[model samples]
Target chain A: MRFIDARCQLGRRCVIRENEPVTKAEILELMDRCRIERAVAYHAIAKEGDVKAGNMELLKDTEGDSRFLRQWVALPHTFGEFMSVEELLKGMKENSVSSIRMFPKTHGYSLKPYALGKFMDAMAEHKIPVFMTYNELASEDALYAMLTDYPKVNFIISDVSYREERKLFPILEHCPNFHIGTGNYVVHGGVKTMCEYFGAERMIFDTGLPTGSAAAAVSLICFAEISEEEKTLIASGNLERMLSEVEL
Target chain B: MRFFDASCRLGRPAAFGEGMPWQTDEILEIMARCHIDGALAYHIVAREGETQDGNELLLREIAQIPQLQPQWCALPATYDEFLHADALRDAMKENGVRTLRIAPKSFAHSARPYAMKELMGFAAECRVPVFFDYGEAPCDELYEICHDYPDVSFVITNTAYALNRWLGPVLDACGNLYLGTGNYVPHRGLETFCKYYAADRLVFNTNLPTGSATAAVSLVCFADISKEEKELIAHGNIERLLGEVRL
Candidate 1:
């Protein structure tokens, strides 16, 4: 089966938990063992206070590789690091950065429209999808403002808490452009609800590896008892569309 | 090269995230994909509040199986349903339910030393081992129970959480405690579990058809240790433990 790991924190294994290190090479080899065809990995560099540098390192590792392409997780908040969209676009073309990840809560920026409006405009102009991290709808108007402004730019919401799941649907209904990524959560009945509500089309498989595993994500999708075809979509097809829509 | 999927959950598979049904054929296929020899599956049927119904169904299914050894779940709240001691023994023993699970959290009962002692004495007298549900932060009483009765063995799932805070203490308290490689916290913490304790105390578990076979295999492959240790934790230890249970 061809599988793509849609999300990861470290490029290589580096104690994603406390002391469990998994290098990038180790990750690929493990994916190979799991029959995974391709995987999209990132540096949890935002947590390090150097988002672009982290993404640059991520791009550097995947520069020559055809199988493992790069997905840049940028902190729009970390704009002092980059002065121009030209450099950002150049990085995307040269380094193959497919998506930009936003951490409104993690970075402590108001995900409110007034705070993110100009940022989303910048992201839309560059034509990169903004992957939102662990969300709380408390900032709904601000988040939706970006969605309406950059409806073309994919808004992928993530870290959907496994406990309070019903909130995702209404939030999803309002933000038509938002897709969900199930990261490191193990609450009961979360995935079943996602497959049931989103029809597996909007739901993409992500294991939050190092913190979790690609096999965990895939097995979760597979164990949902959704048809194998639905599993294919959750594991691969939805991600393919995300990249395809971004014209990557 | 056999597997004992000590982390099997019998309810709807999607409840845990894996969408596959918890049926036997699905399990056999999963074990096959990962080169698993065999699995000892446990069912989680508390959604309808009938943990025993889940056990009965599992026992009926694995009655004659040489591969699938049903690790039965023990819900003390259901004691009244058992009615008599012999009837309870038949329910546990007749259809191949050897290992009994102590899911205190699921039962919503804070574990007590005496409660576990009484229950474990029952299981041990019946010649069955007690395997606790795979949780990291087991209540104070559960530990008390283990310390009180060393003869009873345990299969601790989610050892990552358990080890994070109490690695040294947990290992110190129960030498007989074994780990089930389900969805534990740090994927490779088993290395520490085996290193601190003995590899003999660790078990090869997938929580399969539900837990990631590939991920479980990955932890075995990527863990920073020797092939000897890996062999023991991945296969040998579980085999030895199951053998002790006369499986």
Candidate 2:
């Protein structure tokens, strides 16, 4: 089945070996290998520091490639490093950046609703999707609070494990804008069960590319017990709908 | 791609999930769905209940299915709660047991190299593979056992991520050490592992019913290595190791 990876990264990872940057060609080649039609990617260096520089680099790197959907990193308001929420949204709109990722722990901000009120408000108003991996949301309480407070904001939780359903189900029940990226969600019969309860639209395909195995993720979705229509939703349809709905 | 799953389980999990009965038929069905040809499985009863009863149950469950290889849990030599050295070997031969696993952390047993010296020696002498998974024994102690008993083939199963630092040296030093790729996926990790070490040291495993077998198989199948290397990791290496077992 054709796929559009909702979560991906490029650039030097801080924790791993130095100077091991993955080129756009390599990312595209990996996409071809894994049968991914497109990928939404952020710069890994953005998670380290200087998100502005990282985001700019990500934009520059994917300049000519339409397949590489650009995503910027959102820093805390107190940092005063980037433009105000209004200006940031305007810039993102002009640049065709549809989504943004968060690194709360790295940026030294509490992800409580109050701390991110301004940023979350802008994202909600603009209908921009927010992506948070394990690096951002570490606790269920914090995630619950954020989703509860920002009811309008679309949040995509990527690289989530299947065992986290116990903690995630309660939040999911109440939050309608929440979606899951199936990179690490490899629990046996999890996709089928989740599709049954949550509907297929709430799930999106992701490989956790450049950090995890793309083949593994694709194989998981292909072998899942869900229907072909459900697989199509998770593979690319849901991601395309979310991205297209992004109000410039 | 046919898989000889080195890490799998039968019976219910102790603390996690619903008490779903994971019988032999269910295991075979799951394996078939995932393109797995056979599995080396231990009974959850062996881990939670008495060892002997668990072993007998394991044997009974896999009696008809030759693909489901039974692995018994070994205890310390001092307790004699289970058979030791020669007797253990005799029992293994009689029961068609080719592999053994130990859960030191869960069973409250010491992981010192000397604790299971006799069993390790017997396993090495008999060319049987003794397996350990995450939480069973610390890597350092496992290294010590592998170092002390170079003749014994030691298989480390269900390894966690970000363990390359600890594993690199142990695997480098010990030729007998093999890794079960149940949860070992890092960025281009399988390729790097093949580059640094021999491809034969890596074995295909599912950690099935608990972990995704398809994920494990796809990791090797789509790795950026030669077809021969992929074949070795997929089933050839483990098949060679299993072929050495006398029983």
Candidate 3:
């Protein structure tokens, strides 16, 4: 089945291990091998170095590459250091970017309504999904708060390890907009269980590529004990629908 | 593409997700579904605490099941609280148990030679491969244990991503250290590991009941490595290690 990676990092980042896929060519080769038709990619510089510069770097790196759907790393515009909501939306439309990723913990911003009320409001208005790793939030409590606070906004949290099922289940029960990125959710029979409880629509297939395992990510869906319909939705359909819904 | 899971836990966990496969039948169903040929399973009772009792429980649980091999949890035999080296060896030999697992941190013991010399020495002498989670002997402790028991094959499992930086140096320094590729999900993790360390040091495991067998097997099957290398990682390396067990 065709796959679309929901989370991927383009461009080089610090702490690259020996023989890891770094360049666009290497990443594309892997995506092809894994049958990933396209990847929603954000810039590594945006995550690790400079947010604005890295988002721009993502555009340059993925320029003319149809295989990459652009995703920009967003920062809260405190003191006008970053783009205002209007400017951000305008830039996203101009660039054909559909999704936004944030690093509230990494960027040292508050997820409180007071801190991101306007920005999240704009995201909710545009139907643009926001992405982050499970670690980017301080706790499951913070994650619950964020998801409940922005009930209309879609949030796809990735890299949630096997240990947090108890903590995450209640939140998944309460929050319909909280989707999980199936990159490194390596809990045994986890996908099947999630589908059983939360339904297939709640999962968005992702290979935290260039850093996370593409083979493992795709295999998780491919070998899951769930139905073909569930697999199809998780493999690409859910993410495709989410991206297509972005008004920006 | 045959798989012999190098690390799988048996019995119920203290806490588990809904519908997690923990019983022998449930585990067997998953193993069959995933096309796994066999598994080396340690009981949760043994791993959680009661090393000797858990070891005995493992023997009883897998007595009729030929696909599941017993992997006993070991301790330092402190104050005769556990089995000494000789009795442990005899018991393992009689029961056809070839592998051993330890959790120094959980058992509240130092991994140093002063505490682990007798147990590790038995493992070294018999070529019985020792298993432990990365959390049991993490980072510097991982290196120290490998260095201390250079003769024994040390397979570290449940190593999530973010360990390559710390693990790379250990793999370089210790030839006896083997990696359990259960959840070592770094991008191109197996491919990169093979590039640097060779596939012989990489062992395929599922950390089953908790770790995903589907993900583990898929990681090896779809890895961008040679068929020969994949074969070595999938079962050949682990089979070789188990075959060398003198016990």
In terms of TM-score, the best-performing candidate is 3
Lowest lDDT 10-residue stretch of candidate 1 chain B: B160-169
Arrange candidates by TM-score, descending: 3, 2, 1
Q: Could you give the CAPRI-style class of model 1?
A: incorrect
Quality class of the docking in candidate 3, CAPRI style:
incorrect
- What is the C-alpha lDDT profile of model 1 across A62-154, one tens digit per residue? 667776646766543222333345566666776677777656455433443333455566666666666666553345555566566667567
Model 2 CA lDDT for position A207? 87
- DockQ each candidate and list the results: 0.01, 0.01, 0.01
Clashing pairs in 2: none
iRMSD for each candidate structure, in the order shown: 18.0, 17.1, 16.3
In model 1 chain A, which range of ten residues has the least summed lDDT?
A75-84
Let me know the TM-score candidate 2 reaches against the reference structure. 0.51
Give the best candidate by lDDT.
Answer: 3
TM-score values for chain B across all models: 0.82, 0.93, 0.99
Model 1 C-alpha lDDT per residue in residues B34-59, reported as the tens digit of each score:
77776666665632356677777676
True contacts kept of each: 0.00, 0.00, 0.00
Better of 1 and 3 by TM-score: 3
**Span of 10 residues, lowest total lDDT, candidate 3 chain A:** A106-115
